[model samples]
Target: MKNIIITGTSRGIGYELAWQFADAGHNVLAISRKTPQTLLGNKNITCLSVDLSDETEMEKVDNFLSHSWKTVDIIIHNAGSLLLKPFSETSQEDFENIYKVNVFGVANLTRACLPYLQKGSHVVTISSMGGIQGSLKFAGLAAYSSSKGAVITLSELLAEEYKEKGVSFNVLALGAVQTEMLQEAFPGYEAPITAKEMADYIFDFALTGNKYYNGKVLQVSSTNP
Candidate 1:
């Protein structure tokens, strides 16, 4: 079984992803701002409290993982922040906070874990379709969209850099899924995909050991018609 680390595991997609990995019999290191509600009885899962907003906490996580695991087979940079405010009205503080978690926080965690990542290990980042297309259809998401765009770029760069090292990077560029984050920004909105379903697909993709998927952004949505 693979030793996997996933961030933002308190709820929604993160929560679902943790459960999926654990059920697959992999050792999971789940990280989040608070202990997750879903990992209550899973022995395969280890939940670590980490506020990605705090760089110090992320550093602690880095150190902990480096000391504990000989190597990580998978690292999922899934914790993210979104500020649903118009660009014109977005406060400076919110912008900074968004970038802090979405951009800088991701970078720090990846850098910290790089040393422990071995050949054939995979790095997955949860990006958004917004990162590819600047669809203003969703109002007040400039900060969020811009940050996701940065992630797309980061994934590309890592794919090229890690190719020779036998590491792979894939960005799951997801469409709207039903999650608390979604409801918070778009109340009563209906989405075609659910978080649990998306999590299942991601787990499957990661295990395929297919190098062709490397450095590519895979978009997912409900296959339900």
Candidate 2:
């Protein structure tokens, strides 16, 4: 059983990932701004209420790791913000808010957990297809897409920096998964993939990705143009 930490577990993909991992007999530490009702009674799951964008609140993760876990086998950075607006209408505050949760928050949490990450551990950050160059692009998502682009780059750089340590870092640039976030971003749109399906794939990848991948941004999309 591995010790896994997942952020943004209150709903959608993160919540499903936490459930799947715990059901598979792993020790799961779930972090989110609000606690999910479904995870309240699970023995294998420990929930931490935290706002990833808040450095002071994120310190609680360090404290939890110091007392509860010695080695982290997997860390999935899934917390993010989606700010959809035309570039010309996007406000500075919108950009900052999106970056805070999607980019800076991931950096801060990963930095805090570095000391506890053991050899052969995996770190996966969820990006978006919109962030990939030459892929299908959409308007009104400047801040969200740019933040994910930063996440992809950050994952690659960290993988290079930690190559010798045996810690693998990768990013999953996901397509439109059926979730509240997707609906909010693209109302009345139908996504081919579901959050539970994405969670299953991510759970499997987190378990074995180090064997075949590192420092790479893999796109998880099912859209055809």
Candidate 3:
């Protein structure tokens, strides 16, 4: 069984992904700020209540890997911080806070796991369609969209840096999904996709997409919104 690490497992797509990976007979490390009770008794899963933006908290992942895992097969950077506010009303702190989780946290966490990532390992980052340049843009997402875009670029760079080593890095720019984060960004609007549905796609991609592509961003959207 492959050893996989997933972030943002407290709810939405990450929550569903944790259980799905475990059910598939993989060893899963589920990390989020709040641990989910659903993962409590699973033998295939290890749940960690962690703050991604905190450097100290992320070190625990390294510790766990050193103690129990042979090597990491996959890492899904699913933890995200969303801030929806009009540009004029958004404060500097609000913007920085979003970057802390969406950008800095991604960099720090990836760096921490690199020692355990060998050839054939995949690093999949979950981005948003809003982050894509020239894609549809929405108001009230200045901080959120910008941060997502940064991560997309980050993944591409990592893929380039690790090409010789055969590690793969890719980004999935997802469209509107009916998630709590979506509700915060746009209330009263139903999305074409559900959290579990999106998780299903990610699960498959995390497992095998690296064989076909690496250092690329796949736009996983069927709708404009």
Best by lDDT: 3
Instruction: Candidate 1: list runs displaced more than 4 Å.
Output: 37-40, 134-137, 222-225
lDDT per residue for candidate 3 within 19-129, as digits (tens), equals: 999999999999998898879999999998778888888779988999999599999999998987889999999998999899999999999999999999999999999
A best-first ranking of the candidates according to their lDDT comes to 3, 2, 1
Q: Give candidates' CA RMSD values in order.
A: 2.3, 0.9, 0.9
lDDT of each: 0.83, 0.92, 0.94
For model 1 the local lDDT of residue 23 reads 88
CA error at residue 134 for candidate 1, angstroms: 5.8
Candidate 3, backbone clash total = 0
Instruction: List, residue by residue over 134-204, the lDDT tens digit for candidate 1.
Output: 44346689889889989989988989998998899888878888889989988999888888887878777
The reply for model 2, stretches above 4 Å from the true place, is none
The model with the greater lDDT, 1 or 2, is: 2
Task: Give one digit per residue, the lDDT tens place, for model 2 in 1-225.
Answer: 999999989889999999999999999999999998789899999999999888888689988999989889999999888987889998899899999999999999999999998789999999999889887778888899989999999999999999999999999999989998889888999889899999999999999988999999998988762
Separate clash counts for every candidate = 0, 0, 0
Q: Between the candidate structures 1 and 2, which one is better when assessed by TM-score?
A: 2
Per-residue lDDT value at 143 in model 1 = 89
TM-score of 3: 0.98
**For residue 71, what is the lDDT in candidate 1?**
89
